[model samples]
Target: MSGRAAGGGERLSYFEGYRAIGAVVVVIFHAYQHNRDPVTWHWPLEGTTWHDLLRATDLVVDLFFVQSAFLLGRPYLRACLDGERRQHARAFLVRRAARVLPLYYTAILLVWAISNPILPGDWPDLLLHVTFTQTFSQAKIFYTNGPAWSLAVEMQFYLLLAVLGALAQRICGRLRHRSARLAVLLLGIAVLAGACDGYRLLAVSAWRLPDTYWPAWFGLPAKLDVFAAGLLLALLAAGGVRLPGAAARRLVGAAGIAVLVGGSVVRLRPGFPETFVHGVYGAGCALVHGASVLGGSHGPRWARVRWLVALGGMSYSLYLWHEPVLRLLDSHGLLPERGTAAGFGFTAVLLLAVSLPVAWLSYHAVERTGQFVARAFDGEGRRREYYRPLPDLPAPPQIRDVTEVLSLRGRLPAGTWPTRD
Candidate 1:
């Protein structure tokens, strides 16, 4: 909570721990998908609780979206509410590009080079992915790497946030009071979220588009509600809302966990409507994240464990590479047999063992480098360049000599040398 986490000097909080847990769970979910038999492993209604939880892990992707929105939105919202200088859109986009594009492009190339023979796609698919427009194409959405679709969504969110933030800053400038500005911004976000939710319902229920439809279901429009949850959380935090005490914070956290579990369970029920499933899950994630921020302390002790924090720092790379690593292991016959409890445990453990080191390397090589580049290019970096201290000049020797000579001749008073122009 106090000290910075690994990647940069960004503040560390319970969110990093959440990132670590989410990344690991996603890896396990994919592992289960690969190893389970579709014939025997039915939906949760007929399956075990473990199976339901495994299935529910897919929802963890929304947690990443919420986290991103909260982290990025908080500063902008604070600036608006407090009447501070607004963030530059160009600088924000540049930083986002530096943080996201490098690793994403790397993953695309790596996956293409290694998996082309097995998971083939054409040049247009590659082009779409390169432009972060793959999510618009049903065929290309999961082409290079399945998890990369989320990265595409994240890129879209970044662009949208930059634009919206700039517009919000301008609008807030016209408002008379902080509360008025905050209310107007919050209402705008709420309206946007409501519109997205309506679109999702129409797509799923009325139009009868499958939830797997790329543009309607997996795209930014469908997912903005989740991001709005984070944006709202940021607004509340910016407005100075806080939990009164540890007990209240704990209670909120417990309620969040309950909502999350309850949502997951309901999601697994036979014939549950898909229209609101993701929204419910997003609400739960928001609640949990809200409690973490509103709490007075750093968080629970477990959330601050050094290794967990480190894992969280490397989580982006881990999320990107874990699936490919798992597939590689499977191809080489390194993984255990499928459909057994022992096998699942072994596969999960082996994936973690192999993937952690790879993720650590990627984090250092790609992510950290990206952060450095972002800092070197953004507004702060430009300002630093402009204000950099001038190197100490060799003490204007000619002037000093002239003063000494003038003083010796008594043409200038002692300690009253002429000032340098």
Candidate 2:
């Protein structure tokens, strides 16, 4: 697609709002992202209470995962369906690498700079971050920064996108029917994902071993479904396919609320039979998409909570800096215990206390600077150098998506494609 052709369109405003929510939810989840229980003969469901603050919040990560898949997959999936599938495959990989790696490695290096040099396998862990394949490894993602683990997972999804995306184009080219192509992609995804999940749980009992003990890189098989789910959602959106409009949105929104509330219900009653996970959780994905899509495309109407949006703007930075700050407090005993209301309050307030300013400057200094530098390098040849665009981003100031900017990078200006100035 030409620059002009790609630049004009209505993007999803509800999703931008939803992105803010997803990022914040994930950040909250990451603030206290995990639950601990000793090995037992009984199912690990005990003590995993819905009212339990830390455990309850872990659900937020699910929101983050779904959002990541939707946003990243949109345009590429569009290009594939447009018979220009090959166009995005290269730039998508490059742009994705650039967007993620700089901030990612900087965080990793910052951790390395402060920690013991001689710690066991520290060098290898650092190597993992640099290669952007750290998710496949078993290392605790950041020694000081716990949230980076999810970032690693997100990157892994991108890598999966790069590979599967190329194959998808090849397969899509042979099939003339859009419906057939979509069907094949969906079915491949379903079979592969279900197998992977099964393998991850039943076969890979090696969770107890160090990450290196497992031969695979990044639980690729296990997590493939999550990424596939996102990819399909993107395909749906990019094709101009609309799910249930107002009515569907309301229905799905109600369902999502029910599932979320069901967690609370499961918590309040004994022997309530935790039905959320094993029964129809994937349906919730479609429901959330319906709610967001059906809400329609419109800007924020309320003047109130604008700062929340601004803070949401810096959510990525907060993700980067919040955990370390929390760790700093927790190490010093500034934090309250985990189960108490006081513990949740302490974690939340302490995160916002330092994160607001830090996240703001990070957007300007780190994210924006990194973006500018990445863009400047995107133009090909000797005129521009170093980390040129990966071929997905829309050109700077052209009102294109992020991928188009990368695609414009290192190219001979933007007016024409398959042409050199």
lDDT (CA) per prediction: 0.78, 0.55
Q: What's the TM-score of each model vs. the native?
A: 0.87, 0.70
Candidate 1: TM-score? Answer: 0.87
Tens digits of per-residue lDDT for model 1 on 201-274? 78767898875677778888888888898899889888989999878887887887888888887876777765
Q: Candidate 1, which ten residues in sequence have the lowest lDDT sum?
A: 1-10
Error of 2 at 399 (Å): 50
lDDT of 2 by residue, 1-421 (tens): 0001012123343343444555565555544442112233222233556336444554454555665666666655665677753445556656555566566667667766666466664777677666655555545444435566667677767767767777777787788888887786677667755765665555335453333443242344544555555566666666666644666666767887687656645644653322223223333554566565535533234311456545555567766776666666667887665544445655666766776677787777776665554454332211255555667634434434667656766764555343222
CA shift of 402, model 1, Å: 7.4
**Which residue pairs come into collision in candidate 1?**
none
Best by lDDT: 1
Residue 280 in candidate 1, Cα distance off native in Å:
1.3
lDDT over C-alpha atoms for residue 123 of model 1: 71
